[model samples]
Target: MSSRSNISQYQGLLERIVLCFLSTGPACFFLLINGILMFSLRSKPVFRYTCRYILLYNLLVADTAQLIVTQVLFLLAVGRVKITYAVCGTITTMANLTAGISPLTLVIMTLERYVAVCYPLRHASIVNIKNTVVAIIAAWAVSTLNNVTRNLFLIEYPYEKFGKVLMKDYCTNIGWIPDSLCDDYDRAYNAVVFVSASITVISSYTGVVIAAKAASTDKASALKARKTLLLHLVQLFLSLAYTLYYPLLSALAKTVQRIVFVWVQNVIYVLFIVLPRCLTSLIYGLRDQTVRPVLLHYLFCRWKLSVEPATC
Candidate 1:
Protein backbone atom coordinates (compact mmCIF):
# COMPACT_ATOMS: atom_id res chain seq x y z
CA MET A 1 0.00 0.00 0.00
CA SER A 2 2.82 2.40 0.89
CA SER A 3 4.66 1.65 -2.37
CA ARG A 4 1.51 2.23 -4.44
CA SER A 5 0.88 5.59 -2.77
CA ASN A 6 4.47 6.68 -3.42
CA ILE A 7 4.20 5.80 -7.12
CA SER A 8 0.92 7.67 -7.46
CA GLN A 9 2.41 10.81 -5.89
CA TYR A 10 5.47 10.67 -8.13
CA GLN A 11 3.32 10.23 -11.21
CA GLY A 12 1.13 13.22 -10.30
CA LEU A 13 4.13 15.45 -9.68
CA LEU A 14 5.72 14.43 -12.97
CA GLU A 15 2.48 15.04 -14.80
CA ARG A 16 2.23 18.57 -13.40
CA ILE A 17 5.79 19.42 -14.42
CA VAL A 18 5.16 18.28 -17.97
CA LEU A 19 1.87 20.18 -18.11
CA CYS A 20 3.56 23.40 -17.05
CA PHE A 21 6.19 23.02 -19.76
CA LEU A 22 3.56 22.24 -22.41
CA SER A 23 1.66 25.40 -21.59
CA THR A 24 4.51 27.85 -20.95
CA GLY A 25 6.51 26.79 -24.00
CA PRO A 26 4.23 28.49 -26.53
CA ALA A 27 3.69 31.51 -24.30
CA CYS A 28 7.42 32.13 -24.23
CA PHE A 29 7.60 31.83 -28.03
CA PHE A 30 4.77 34.32 -28.50
CA LEU A 31 6.44 36.67 -26.03
CA LEU A 32 9.62 36.63 -28.11
CA ILE A 33 7.67 37.19 -31.34
CA ASN A 34 5.70 40.09 -29.89
CA GLY A 35 8.86 41.69 -28.55
CA ILE A 36 10.37 41.56 -32.03
CA LEU A 37 7.27 43.03 -33.65
CA MET A 38 7.19 45.84 -31.10
CA PHE A 39 10.79 46.66 -31.88
CA SER A 40 10.05 46.54 -35.60
CA LEU A 41 7.19 48.99 -35.20
CA ARG A 42 9.60 51.50 -33.69
CA SER A 43 12.39 50.77 -36.17
CA LYS A 44 10.99 52.71 -39.13
CA PRO A 45 9.73 56.28 -39.56
CA VAL A 46 6.65 55.17 -41.51
CA PHE A 47 5.46 52.85 -38.74
CA ARG A 48 5.79 55.69 -36.27
CA TYR A 49 3.87 58.13 -38.48
CA THR A 50 1.08 55.86 -39.79
CA CYS A 51 -2.22 55.84 -37.90
CA ARG A 52 -2.95 52.10 -38.26
CA TYR A 53 0.54 50.88 -37.36
CA ILE A 54 0.51 53.05 -34.24
CA LEU A 55 -2.73 51.38 -33.18
CA LEU A 56 -1.22 47.93 -33.82
CA TYR A 57 1.67 48.83 -31.57
CA ASN A 58 -0.77 49.89 -28.87
CA LEU A 59 -2.65 46.60 -29.18
CA LEU A 60 0.58 44.56 -28.93
CA VAL A 61 1.56 46.30 -25.70
CA ALA A 62 -1.71 45.40 -24.03
CA ASP A 63 -1.67 41.79 -25.28
CA THR A 64 1.89 41.23 -24.09
CA ALA A 65 1.09 42.49 -20.59
CA GLN A 66 -1.99 40.30 -20.36
CA LEU A 67 0.01 37.27 -21.52
CA ILE A 68 2.55 37.74 -18.72
CA VAL A 69 -0.15 38.00 -16.06
CA THR A 70 -1.92 34.94 -17.43
CA GLN A 71 1.28 32.85 -17.40
CA VAL A 72 1.84 33.77 -13.73
CA LEU A 73 -1.67 32.66 -12.79
CA PHE A 74 -1.20 29.41 -14.71
CA LEU A 75 2.06 28.63 -12.91
CA LEU A 76 0.47 29.28 -9.53
CA ALA A 77 -2.44 27.00 -10.31
CA VAL A 78 -0.29 24.16 -11.62
CA GLY A 79 2.27 24.33 -8.83
CA ARG A 80 -0.42 24.63 -6.16
CA VAL A 81 1.21 27.78 -4.85
CA LYS A 82 -1.01 29.53 -2.33
CA ILE A 83 -1.70 33.28 -2.56
CA THR A 84 -3.61 35.74 -0.36
CA TYR A 85 -6.96 37.18 -1.31
CA ALA A 86 -5.38 40.61 -1.66
CA VAL A 87 -2.62 39.31 -3.91
CA CYS A 88 -5.07 37.30 -5.96
CA GLY A 89 -7.43 40.23 -6.30
CA THR A 90 -4.70 42.56 -7.49
CA ILE A 91 -3.35 40.11 -10.06
CA THR A 92 -6.76 39.12 -11.34
CA THR A 93 -7.83 42.74 -11.60
CA MET A 94 -4.80 43.54 -13.71
CA ALA A 95 -5.63 40.61 -15.98
CA ASN A 96 -9.24 41.73 -16.40
CA LEU A 97 -8.21 45.33 -17.03
CA THR A 98 -5.71 44.41 -19.73
CA ALA A 99 -8.10 41.98 -21.41
CA GLY A 100 -10.61 44.79 -21.94
CA ILE A 101 -8.10 46.85 -23.92
CA SER A 102 -7.85 44.41 -26.87
CA PRO A 103 -11.48 44.66 -27.99
CA LEU A 104 -11.51 48.40 -27.61
CA THR A 105 -8.37 48.72 -29.72
CA LEU A 106 -9.95 46.45 -32.31
CA VAL A 107 -13.01 48.66 -32.51
CA ILE A 108 -10.80 51.68 -33.05
CA MET A 109 -8.76 49.88 -35.71
CA THR A 110 -11.92 48.79 -37.51
CA LEU A 111 -13.21 52.35 -37.60
CA GLU A 112 -9.86 53.57 -38.90
CA ARG A 113 -10.00 51.03 -41.71
CA TYR A 114 -13.54 52.12 -42.52
CA VAL A 115 -12.41 55.72 -42.87
CA ALA A 116 -9.41 54.80 -45.03
CA VAL A 117 -11.64 52.76 -47.35
CA CYS A 118 -14.90 54.74 -47.51
CA TYR A 119 -13.59 58.27 -47.12
CA PRO A 120 -10.12 58.17 -48.60
CA LEU A 121 -10.24 61.88 -49.50
CA ARG A 122 -10.37 62.85 -45.83
CA HIS A 123 -8.52 59.88 -44.31
CA ALA A 124 -5.39 61.93 -43.77
CA SER A 125 -7.10 64.84 -41.98
CA ILE A 126 -9.59 62.66 -40.13
CA VAL A 127 -7.13 60.10 -38.77
CA ASN A 128 -4.11 62.17 -38.05
CA ILE A 129 -1.35 61.59 -35.49
CA LYS A 130 -3.05 63.75 -32.87
CA ASN A 131 -6.38 61.96 -33.29
CA THR A 132 -4.72 58.50 -33.15
CA VAL A 133 -2.97 59.42 -29.91
CA VAL A 134 -6.24 60.59 -28.44
CA ALA A 135 -8.00 57.39 -29.52
CA ILE A 136 -5.36 55.21 -27.85
CA ILE A 137 -5.61 57.33 -24.71
CA ALA A 138 -9.38 57.03 -24.72
CA ALA A 139 -9.09 53.22 -24.99
CA TRP A 140 -6.80 53.03 -21.96
CA ALA A 141 -8.94 55.51 -20.04
CA VAL A 142 -12.06 53.41 -20.55
CA SER A 143 -10.28 50.24 -19.47
CA THR A 144 -9.02 52.08 -16.38
CA LEU A 145 -12.56 53.21 -15.57
CA ASN A 146 -13.72 49.62 -15.78
CA ASN A 147 -10.83 48.63 -13.51
CA VAL A 148 -11.88 51.31 -11.03
CA THR A 149 -15.46 50.05 -11.01
CA ARG A 150 -14.24 46.52 -10.28
CA ASN A 151 -12.14 47.72 -7.35
CA LEU A 152 -15.10 49.64 -5.93
CA PHE A 153 -17.26 46.55 -6.01
CA LEU A 154 -14.43 44.57 -4.42
CA ILE A 155 -14.17 47.03 -1.48
CA GLU A 156 -17.58 45.91 -0.23
CA TYR A 157 -16.25 42.40 0.48
CA PRO A 158 -15.49 41.65 4.13
CA TYR A 159 -11.73 41.25 3.84
CA GLU A 160 -11.19 42.75 7.29
CA LYS A 161 -12.90 39.80 9.00
CA PHE A 162 -10.18 37.47 7.78
CA GLY A 163 -6.93 39.38 7.88
CA LYS A 164 -4.17 38.28 5.49
CA VAL A 165 -6.19 35.29 4.44
CA LEU A 166 -4.98 32.85 1.80
CA MET A 167 -7.46 31.95 -0.92
CA LYS A 168 -8.80 28.37 -1.01
CA ASP A 169 -8.50 27.99 -4.77
CA TYR A 170 -5.74 29.00 -7.17
CA CYS A 171 -5.57 32.70 -7.96
CA THR A 172 -7.74 33.58 -10.93
CA ASN A 173 -10.09 36.32 -12.09
CA ILE A 174 -12.94 34.08 -10.97
CA GLY A 175 -11.24 32.63 -7.87
CA TRP A 176 -12.66 34.80 -5.10
CA ILE A 177 -15.61 36.45 -6.73
CA PRO A 178 -16.79 38.96 -4.10
CA ASP A 179 -20.49 39.11 -4.81
CA SER A 180 -23.26 38.52 -7.33
CA LEU A 181 -23.44 42.25 -7.89
CA CYS A 182 -19.87 42.34 -9.19
CA ASP A 183 -20.51 39.33 -11.39
CA ASP A 184 -23.62 40.95 -12.81
CA TYR A 185 -21.71 44.15 -13.42
CA ASP A 186 -18.94 42.21 -15.18
CA ARG A 187 -21.43 40.36 -17.39
CA ALA A 188 -23.19 43.55 -18.39
CA TYR A 189 -19.95 45.36 -19.08
CA ASN A 190 -18.63 42.50 -21.18
CA ALA A 191 -21.91 42.21 -23.06
CA VAL A 192 -22.02 45.88 -23.92
CA VAL A 193 -18.39 46.02 -25.01
CA PHE A 194 -18.60 42.88 -27.09
CA VAL A 195 -21.91 43.77 -28.74
CA SER A 196 -21.01 47.37 -29.47
CA ALA A 197 -17.59 46.44 -30.86
CA SER A 198 -18.92 43.61 -32.99
CA ILE A 199 -21.67 45.77 -34.45
CA THR A 200 -19.16 48.48 -35.27
CA VAL A 201 -16.77 46.10 -37.01
CA ILE A 202 -19.48 44.23 -38.90
CA SER A 203 -21.28 47.38 -39.96
CA SER A 204 -18.05 48.95 -41.10
CA TYR A 205 -17.24 45.84 -43.08
CA THR A 206 -20.61 46.05 -44.85
CA GLY A 207 -20.09 49.71 -45.66
CA VAL A 208 -16.64 49.06 -47.09
CA VAL A 209 -18.06 46.34 -49.34
CA ILE A 210 -20.75 48.68 -50.55
CA ALA A 211 -18.23 51.41 -51.21
CA ALA A 212 -16.05 49.01 -53.21
CA LYS A 213 -19.01 48.14 -55.43
CA ALA A 214 -20.18 51.73 -55.94
CA ALA A 215 -17.00 53.82 -56.24
CA SER A 216 -13.59 53.35 -57.85
CA THR A 217 -11.94 52.89 -54.45
CA ASP A 218 -8.80 50.90 -55.29
CA LYS A 219 -10.24 47.40 -55.65
CA ALA A 220 -7.16 45.72 -54.16
CA SER A 221 -7.05 48.04 -51.16
CA ALA A 222 -10.77 47.64 -50.52
CA LEU A 223 -10.47 43.84 -50.66
CA LYS A 224 -7.60 43.87 -48.17
CA ALA A 225 -9.48 46.25 -45.86
CA ARG A 226 -12.48 43.94 -45.84
CA LYS A 227 -10.24 40.98 -45.03
CA THR A 228 -8.60 42.90 -42.18
CA LEU A 229 -12.00 43.83 -40.78
CA LEU A 230 -13.02 40.18 -40.87
CA LEU A 231 -9.79 39.28 -39.05
CA HIS A 232 -10.74 41.84 -36.42
CA LEU A 233 -14.00 40.00 -35.83
CA VAL A 234 -12.10 36.70 -35.52
CA GLN A 235 -9.80 38.36 -33.00
CA LEU A 236 -12.82 39.52 -31.01
CA PHE A 237 -14.02 35.92 -30.77
CA LEU A 238 -10.59 34.79 -29.56
CA SER A 239 -10.45 37.59 -26.96
CA LEU A 240 -13.90 36.65 -25.66
CA ALA A 241 -12.70 33.06 -25.36
CA TYR A 242 -9.93 34.27 -23.06
CA THR A 243 -12.51 35.96 -20.82
CA LEU A 244 -14.77 32.90 -20.60
CA TYR A 245 -12.26 29.99 -20.70
CA TYR A 246 -11.73 29.83 -16.93
CA PRO A 247 -15.39 29.76 -15.96
CA LEU A 248 -15.96 27.25 -18.73
CA LEU A 249 -13.19 24.93 -17.53
CA SER A 250 -14.43 25.24 -13.95
CA ALA A 251 -17.96 24.28 -14.93
CA LEU A 252 -16.63 21.34 -16.94
CA ALA A 253 -14.56 20.12 -14.00
CA LYS A 254 -17.71 19.27 -12.08
CA THR A 255 -18.71 16.74 -14.74
CA VAL A 256 -15.36 15.09 -15.49
CA GLN A 257 -12.70 13.10 -13.67
CA ARG A 258 -9.64 14.85 -12.29
CA ILE A 259 -7.32 13.43 -14.95
CA VAL A 260 -9.68 14.43 -17.72
CA PHE A 261 -10.10 17.94 -16.35
CA VAL A 262 -6.36 18.52 -16.23
CA TRP A 263 -5.81 17.53 -19.84
CA VAL A 264 -8.79 19.52 -21.13
CA GLN A 265 -7.69 22.60 -19.21
CA ASN A 266 -4.19 22.45 -20.66
CA VAL A 267 -5.51 22.16 -24.24
CA ILE A 268 -7.96 24.98 -23.78
CA TYR A 269 -5.38 27.18 -22.05
CA VAL A 270 -2.96 26.89 -24.99
CA LEU A 271 -5.70 27.63 -27.50
CA PHE A 272 -7.38 30.47 -25.61
CA ILE A 273 -4.35 32.05 -23.98
CA VAL A 274 -1.39 31.22 -26.16
CA LEU A 275 -2.95 31.39 -29.63
CA PRO A 276 -4.85 34.67 -29.19
CA ARG A 277 -2.08 36.56 -27.46
CA CYS A 278 0.36 36.04 -30.34
CA LEU A 279 -2.23 36.62 -33.06
CA THR A 280 -1.59 40.34 -33.37
CA SER A 281 2.06 39.70 -34.04
CA LEU A 282 1.28 37.21 -36.78
CA ILE A 283 -1.38 39.43 -38.35
CA TYR A 284 0.58 42.64 -38.73
CA GLY A 285 4.10 41.32 -38.43
CA LEU A 286 3.81 39.10 -41.48
CA ARG A 287 0.78 40.51 -43.31
CA ASP A 288 1.68 44.17 -43.58
CA GLN A 289 4.07 44.77 -46.47
CA THR A 290 5.75 47.73 -44.79
CA VAL A 291 6.19 45.85 -41.51
CA ARG A 292 7.25 42.43 -42.82
CA PRO A 293 10.79 43.21 -43.98
CA VAL A 294 11.52 45.23 -40.85
CA LEU A 295 9.94 42.63 -38.57
CA LEU A 296 11.86 39.86 -40.31
CA HIS A 297 15.04 41.88 -40.00
CA TYR A 298 14.53 42.15 -36.26
CA LEU A 299 13.44 38.52 -35.92
CA PHE A 300 16.69 37.46 -37.55
CA CYS A 301 18.77 39.79 -35.38
CA ARG A 302 19.19 42.35 -38.20
CA TRP A 303 21.37 40.02 -40.22
CA LYS A 304 19.76 40.90 -43.59
CA LEU A 305 17.36 43.45 -45.04
CA SER A 306 16.70 43.79 -48.80
CA VAL A 307 12.95 43.80 -49.43
CA GLU A 308 11.26 47.10 -50.25
CA PRO A 309 8.20 48.24 -48.33
CA ALA A 310 4.90 47.13 -49.90
CA THR A 311 1.23 47.97 -49.28
CA CYS A 312 -0.12 46.66 -45.97
Candidate 2:
Protein backbone atom coordinates (compact mmCIF):
# COMPACT_ATOMS: atom_id res chain seq x y z
CA MET A 1 0.00 0.00 0.00
CA SER A 2 2.89 2.38 0.80
CA SER A 3 4.59 1.69 -2.54
CA ARG A 4 1.29 2.16 -4.42
CA SER A 5 0.66 5.42 -2.63
CA ASN A 6 4.12 6.70 -3.50
CA ILE A 7 3.65 5.80 -7.15
CA SER A 8 0.29 7.54 -7.19
CA GLN A 9 1.82 10.74 -5.83
CA TYR A 10 4.52 10.67 -8.46
CA GLN A 11 1.97 10.12 -11.20
CA GLY A 12 -0.10 13.04 -10.01
CA LEU A 13 2.94 15.29 -9.95
CA LEU A 14 3.88 14.27 -13.48
CA GLU A 15 0.35 14.92 -14.68
CA ARG A 16 0.37 18.42 -13.26
CA ILE A 17 3.70 19.26 -14.84
CA VAL A 18 2.40 18.07 -18.20
CA LEU A 19 -0.79 20.05 -17.74
CA CYS A 20 1.15 23.24 -17.10
CA PHE A 21 3.14 22.79 -20.27
CA LEU A 22 0.01 22.10 -22.31
CA SER A 23 -1.69 25.18 -20.94
CA THR A 24 1.20 27.61 -21.50
CA GLY A 25 2.44 26.29 -24.85
CA PRO A 26 -0.78 26.92 -26.76
CA ALA A 27 -1.32 30.21 -24.99
CA CYS A 28 2.05 31.57 -26.10
CA PHE A 29 1.47 30.35 -29.64
CA PHE A 30 -2.02 31.90 -29.73
CA LEU A 31 -0.69 35.24 -28.58
CA LEU A 32 2.10 35.15 -31.14
CA ILE A 33 -0.13 34.33 -34.12
CA ASN A 34 -2.87 36.74 -33.09
CA GLY A 35 -0.34 39.51 -32.49
CA ILE A 36 1.12 39.02 -35.95
CA LEU A 37 -2.35 38.90 -37.51
CA MET A 38 -3.33 42.13 -35.80
CA PHE A 39 -0.16 43.83 -36.94
CA SER A 40 -0.66 42.64 -40.51
CA LEU A 41 -4.24 43.85 -40.46
CA ARG A 42 -3.22 47.30 -39.26
CA SER A 43 -0.34 47.72 -41.68
CA LYS A 44 -2.40 46.85 -44.74
CA PRO A 45 -5.28 49.24 -45.14
CA VAL A 46 -7.08 47.25 -47.81
CA PHE A 47 -7.42 44.03 -45.78
CA ARG A 48 -8.19 46.00 -42.63
CA TYR A 49 -11.17 47.81 -44.16
CA THR A 50 -13.30 44.82 -45.19
CA CYS A 51 -16.25 43.76 -43.03
CA ARG A 52 -15.14 40.13 -42.82
CA TYR A 53 -11.64 41.08 -41.69
CA ILE A 54 -13.05 43.49 -39.11
CA LEU A 55 -15.28 40.77 -37.63
CA LEU A 56 -12.37 38.32 -37.69
CA TYR A 57 -10.26 40.85 -35.82
CA ASN A 58 -12.93 41.19 -33.16
CA LEU A 59 -13.15 37.42 -32.80
CA LEU A 60 -9.37 37.21 -32.42
CA VAL A 61 -9.48 39.88 -29.73
CA ALA A 62 -12.17 38.09 -27.75
CA ASP A 63 -10.42 34.73 -28.01
CA THR A 64 -7.13 36.23 -26.89
CA ALA A 65 -8.76 37.85 -23.88
CA GLN A 66 -10.45 34.61 -22.90
CA LEU A 67 -7.22 32.65 -23.42
CA ILE A 68 -5.27 34.95 -21.09
CA VAL A 69 -7.84 34.70 -18.33
CA THR A 70 -8.06 30.95 -18.70
CA GLN A 71 -4.28 30.58 -18.46
CA VAL A 72 -4.29 32.56 -15.22
CA LEU A 73 -6.99 30.33 -13.82
CA PHE A 74 -5.14 27.22 -14.99
CA LEU A 75 -1.93 28.31 -13.28
CA LEU A 76 -3.79 28.96 -10.06
CA ALA A 77 -5.50 25.59 -10.30
CA VAL A 78 -2.28 23.72 -10.92
CA GLY A 79 -0.62 25.38 -7.93
CA ARG A 80 -3.59 24.32 -5.78
CA VAL A 81 -3.53 27.74 -4.18
CA LYS A 82 -6.38 29.34 -2.32
CA ILE A 83 -7.51 32.74 -3.59
CA THR A 84 -9.58 35.52 -2.08
CA TYR A 85 -13.22 35.70 -3.03
CA ALA A 86 -12.82 39.16 -4.50
CA VAL A 87 -9.92 38.15 -6.71
CA CYS A 88 -11.63 34.97 -7.81
CA GLY A 89 -14.84 36.80 -8.55
CA THR A 90 -13.01 39.35 -10.70
CA ILE A 91 -11.28 36.61 -12.68
CA THR A 92 -14.52 34.70 -13.12
CA THR A 93 -16.29 37.83 -14.34
CA MET A 94 -13.64 38.63 -16.92
CA ALA A 95 -13.56 35.04 -18.13
CA ASN A 96 -17.31 34.87 -18.46
CA LEU A 97 -17.42 38.21 -20.28
CA THR A 98 -14.84 37.15 -22.84
CA ALA A 99 -16.38 33.68 -23.29
CA GLY A 100 -19.78 35.23 -23.87
CA ILE A 101 -18.37 37.52 -26.54
CA SER A 102 -16.97 34.62 -28.61
CA PRO A 103 -20.33 33.00 -29.39
CA LEU A 104 -22.01 36.35 -30.05
CA THR A 105 -19.22 37.37 -32.41
CA LEU A 106 -19.47 33.97 -34.11
CA VAL A 107 -23.17 34.46 -34.67
CA ILE A 108 -22.42 37.85 -36.18
CA MET A 109 -19.82 36.30 -38.44
CA THR A 110 -22.31 33.66 -39.54
CA LEU A 111 -24.86 36.32 -40.39
CA GLU A 112 -22.28 38.31 -42.32
CA ARG A 113 -21.32 35.24 -44.31
CA TYR A 114 -24.96 34.42 -44.92
CA VAL A 115 -25.53 37.83 -46.41
CA ALA A 116 -22.43 37.72 -48.53
CA VAL A 117 -23.09 34.26 -49.92
CA CYS A 118 -26.88 34.33 -50.14
CA TYR A 119 -27.28 37.84 -51.45
CA PRO A 120 -24.20 38.62 -53.46
CA LEU A 121 -25.70 41.67 -55.16
CA ARG A 122 -26.70 43.33 -51.86
CA HIS A 123 -23.71 42.13 -49.80
CA ALA A 124 -21.77 45.33 -50.53
CA SER A 125 -24.49 47.70 -49.36
CA ILE A 126 -25.69 45.53 -46.50
CA VAL A 127 -22.37 44.87 -44.77
CA ASN A 128 -20.45 48.10 -45.08
CA ILE A 129 -17.75 49.37 -42.70
CA LYS A 130 -20.17 51.51 -40.67
CA ASN A 131 -22.72 48.75 -40.04
CA THR A 132 -19.97 46.23 -39.36
CA VAL A 133 -18.62 48.47 -36.61
CA VAL A 134 -22.11 48.81 -35.16
CA ALA A 135 -22.60 45.08 -35.25
CA ILE A 136 -19.28 44.47 -33.50
CA ILE A 137 -20.13 47.05 -30.82
CA ALA A 138 -23.55 45.52 -30.36
CA ALA A 139 -22.03 42.04 -30.00
CA TRP A 140 -19.76 43.24 -27.18
CA ALA A 141 -22.60 45.13 -25.48
CA VAL A 142 -24.97 42.18 -25.62
CA SER A 143 -22.32 39.72 -24.42
CA THR A 144 -21.40 42.02 -21.53
CA LEU A 145 -25.04 42.35 -20.47
CA ASN A 146 -25.57 38.60 -20.65
CA ASN A 147 -22.45 37.78 -18.64
CA VAL A 148 -23.00 40.48 -16.00
CA THR A 149 -26.64 39.57 -15.45
CA ARG A 150 -25.99 35.84 -15.37
CA ASN A 151 -23.01 36.18 -13.05
CA LEU A 152 -25.03 38.29 -10.64
CA PHE A 153 -27.44 35.45 -10.07
CA LEU A 154 -24.76 32.79 -9.98
CA ILE A 155 -22.48 34.35 -7.33
CA GLU A 156 -23.15 35.95 -3.94
CA TYR A 157 -20.16 37.96 -2.70
CA PRO A 158 -20.82 37.78 1.02
CA TYR A 159 -20.73 34.01 1.05
CA GLU A 160 -19.90 33.65 4.73
CA LYS A 161 -21.47 34.95 7.91
CA PHE A 162 -18.80 37.64 8.44
CA GLY A 163 -19.07 38.65 4.74
CA LYS A 164 -15.31 39.12 4.35
CA VAL A 165 -13.34 35.90 4.24
CA LEU A 166 -14.13 33.57 1.39
CA MET A 167 -11.29 31.36 0.24
CA LYS A 168 -11.20 28.26 -1.95
CA ASP A 169 -8.64 25.84 -3.33
CA TYR A 170 -9.93 26.38 -6.83
CA CYS A 171 -11.30 29.55 -8.39
CA THR A 172 -14.19 28.63 -10.62
CA ASN A 173 -17.92 29.05 -11.09
CA ILE A 174 -18.41 25.94 -8.96
CA GLY A 175 -17.06 27.91 -5.97
CA TRP A 176 -19.31 30.91 -6.58
CA ILE A 177 -22.62 29.06 -6.44
CA PRO A 178 -23.20 27.65 -2.99
CA ASP A 179 -26.19 25.40 -3.80
CA SER A 180 -28.18 23.60 -6.46
CA LEU A 181 -30.57 26.50 -6.99
CA CYS A 182 -27.85 28.75 -8.32
CA ASP A 183 -26.61 25.88 -10.44
CA ASP A 184 -30.05 25.43 -11.94
CA TYR A 185 -30.32 29.15 -12.57
CA ASP A 186 -26.98 29.20 -14.39
CA ARG A 187 -27.99 26.21 -16.49
CA ALA A 188 -31.33 27.74 -17.44
CA TYR A 189 -29.75 31.00 -18.50
CA ASN A 190 -27.11 29.27 -20.57
CA ALA A 191 -29.72 27.00 -22.14
CA VAL A 192 -31.75 29.92 -23.42
CA VAL A 193 -28.75 31.68 -24.93
CA PHE A 194 -27.36 28.47 -26.38
CA VAL A 195 -30.63 27.50 -28.00
CA SER A 196 -31.20 30.95 -29.45
CA ALA A 197 -27.71 31.12 -30.86
CA SER A 198 -28.04 27.62 -32.25
CA ILE A 199 -31.24 28.50 -34.07
CA THR A 200 -29.73 31.61 -35.61
CA VAL A 201 -26.55 29.85 -36.68
CA ILE A 202 -28.36 26.88 -38.16
CA SER A 203 -30.77 29.11 -40.07
CA SER A 204 -27.98 31.29 -41.42
CA TYR A 205 -25.82 28.37 -42.55
CA THR A 206 -28.81 26.61 -44.06
CA GLY A 207 -29.45 29.68 -46.16
CA VAL A 208 -25.84 29.76 -47.21
CA VAL A 209 -26.00 26.12 -48.30
CA ILE A 210 -29.14 26.75 -50.30
CA ALA A 211 -27.62 29.81 -51.89
CA ALA A 212 -24.48 27.95 -52.81
CA LYS A 213 -26.50 25.22 -54.44
CA ALA A 214 -28.43 27.73 -56.47
CA ALA A 215 -25.23 29.36 -57.68
CA SER A 216 -23.80 26.12 -59.03
CA THR A 217 -23.68 27.62 -62.52
CA ASP A 218 -21.04 30.07 -61.33
CA LYS A 219 -18.23 27.72 -60.30
CA ALA A 220 -16.12 30.38 -58.65
CA SER A 221 -18.93 31.80 -56.55
CA ALA A 222 -20.21 28.36 -55.57
CA LEU A 223 -16.75 27.20 -54.54
CA LYS A 224 -16.18 30.28 -52.44
CA ALA A 225 -19.57 29.90 -50.80
CA ARG A 226 -18.90 26.26 -49.95
CA LYS A 227 -15.48 27.00 -48.50
CA THR A 228 -16.81 29.83 -46.34
CA LEU A 229 -19.75 27.76 -45.14
CA LEU A 230 -17.45 24.87 -44.20
CA LEU A 231 -15.24 27.17 -42.15
CA HIS A 232 -18.28 28.63 -40.36
CA LEU A 233 -19.49 25.13 -39.56
CA VAL A 234 -16.13 24.16 -38.05
CA GLN A 235 -16.13 27.30 -35.93
CA LEU A 236 -19.68 26.66 -34.78
CA PHE A 237 -18.73 23.11 -33.79
CA LEU A 238 -15.75 24.38 -31.78
CA SER A 239 -17.88 26.99 -30.06
CA LEU A 240 -20.40 24.36 -29.08
CA ALA A 241 -17.65 22.13 -27.70
CA TYR A 242 -16.15 24.98 -25.70
CA THR A 243 -19.52 25.94 -24.23
CA LEU A 244 -20.78 22.47 -23.36
CA TYR A 245 -17.59 20.63 -22.40
CA TYR A 246 -17.06 22.47 -19.11
CA PRO A 247 -20.50 21.83 -17.66
CA LEU A 248 -20.30 18.18 -18.51
CA LEU A 249 -16.83 17.86 -17.00
CA SER A 250 -17.87 19.72 -13.89
CA ALA A 251 -20.76 17.36 -13.38
CA LEU A 252 -18.49 14.38 -13.83
CA ALA A 253 -15.95 15.80 -11.42
CA LYS A 254 -18.47 15.65 -8.61
CA THR A 255 -18.91 11.90 -9.02
CA VAL A 256 -15.25 10.91 -9.36
CA GLN A 257 -12.43 10.47 -6.86
CA ARG A 258 -10.21 13.50 -6.27
CA ILE A 259 -7.22 12.14 -8.19
CA VAL A 260 -9.33 11.06 -11.14
CA PHE A 261 -11.25 14.31 -11.24
CA VAL A 262 -8.12 16.44 -11.29
CA TRP A 263 -6.62 14.56 -14.22
CA VAL A 264 -9.89 14.55 -16.14
CA GLN A 265 -10.53 18.24 -15.67
CA ASN A 266 -7.00 19.20 -16.71
CA VAL A 267 -7.20 17.18 -19.89
CA ILE A 268 -10.63 18.54 -20.81
CA TYR A 269 -9.60 22.12 -20.07
CA VAL A 270 -6.61 22.03 -22.38
CA LEU A 271 -8.25 20.00 -25.13
CA PHE A 272 -11.66 21.65 -25.33
CA ILE A 273 -11.11 25.14 -23.99
CA VAL A 274 -7.53 26.15 -24.80
CA LEU A 275 -7.02 24.31 -28.07
CA PRO A 276 -10.12 25.73 -29.73
CA ARG A 277 -9.23 29.31 -28.91
CA CYS A 278 -5.74 28.87 -30.30
CA LEU A 279 -7.10 27.26 -33.47
CA THR A 280 -9.61 30.05 -34.08
CA SER A 281 -6.96 32.44 -35.36
CA LEU A 282 -5.27 29.80 -37.49
CA ILE A 283 -8.32 28.05 -38.92
CA TYR A 284 -10.67 30.97 -39.35
CA GLY A 285 -8.64 34.15 -39.61
CA LEU A 286 -5.25 33.27 -41.04
CA ARG A 287 -6.62 30.89 -43.68
CA ASP A 288 -8.77 33.67 -45.06
CA GLN A 289 -7.63 34.82 -48.52
CA THR A 290 -7.51 38.51 -47.79
CA VAL A 291 -5.60 38.05 -44.56
CA ARG A 292 -3.37 35.18 -45.70
CA PRO A 293 -1.53 37.21 -48.32
CA VAL A 294 -0.81 39.97 -45.84
CA LEU A 295 0.54 37.42 -43.35
CA LEU A 296 2.68 35.78 -46.02
CA HIS A 297 3.93 39.11 -47.27
CA TYR A 298 4.96 40.21 -43.82
CA LEU A 299 6.69 36.94 -42.92
CA PHE A 300 8.31 36.30 -46.32
CA CYS A 301 8.23 39.05 -48.93
CA ARG A 302 7.92 42.34 -47.03
CA TRP A 303 11.62 43.16 -47.47
CA LYS A 304 11.81 42.35 -51.16
CA LEU A 305 9.11 44.31 -52.93
CA SER A 306 5.68 45.85 -52.64
CA VAL A 307 2.77 43.37 -52.68
CA GLU A 308 -0.45 44.41 -54.39
CA PRO A 309 -3.66 44.34 -52.41
CA ALA A 310 -5.95 41.39 -53.10
CA THR A 311 -9.55 41.98 -54.17
CA CYS A 312 -12.18 41.42 -51.51
Q: Which candidate is the best by lDDT?
A: 1
Please provide, for model 2 over 1-312, each residue's C-alpha lDDT reduced to its tens digit, 9 standing for 90 to 100.
999999998987887888788778877877888777777767766767778878888888888888899889888888777777777878877887887777778777878877777777888899898998998899888878866676666445455632356565588767754567666766776677677777877787677667656734355665675676566666766765666665767798789987787778777887778877877768755666666776766666474434456433
Q: What would you estimate as the lDDT of candidate 1? A: 0.88
Off by over 4 Å in 2: 1-15, 154-164, 213-218, 254-257, 297-307, 310-312
Among all windows of ten consecutive residues in candidate 2, which has the lowest summed lDDT?
303-312
Global fold similarity of model 2 (TM-score): 0.84
Q: Candidate 1: deviation at residue 225, Å?
A: 0.8
Clashing pairs in 2: none
Each candidate: how many clashes?
Answer: 0, 0
Backbone collision tally, model 1: 0
Q: Per-residue lDDT of 184-283 in model 1, one digit per residue for the tens?
A: 8988999999999999999999999999997578899899999999999999988777867877887988999999898889898999988998999998
Local distance difference test scores for all models = 0.88, 0.74
Scanning candidate 1 in windows of ten residues, the lowest lDDT window is 303-312
Question: Could you say which candidate leads in TM-score?
Answer: 1
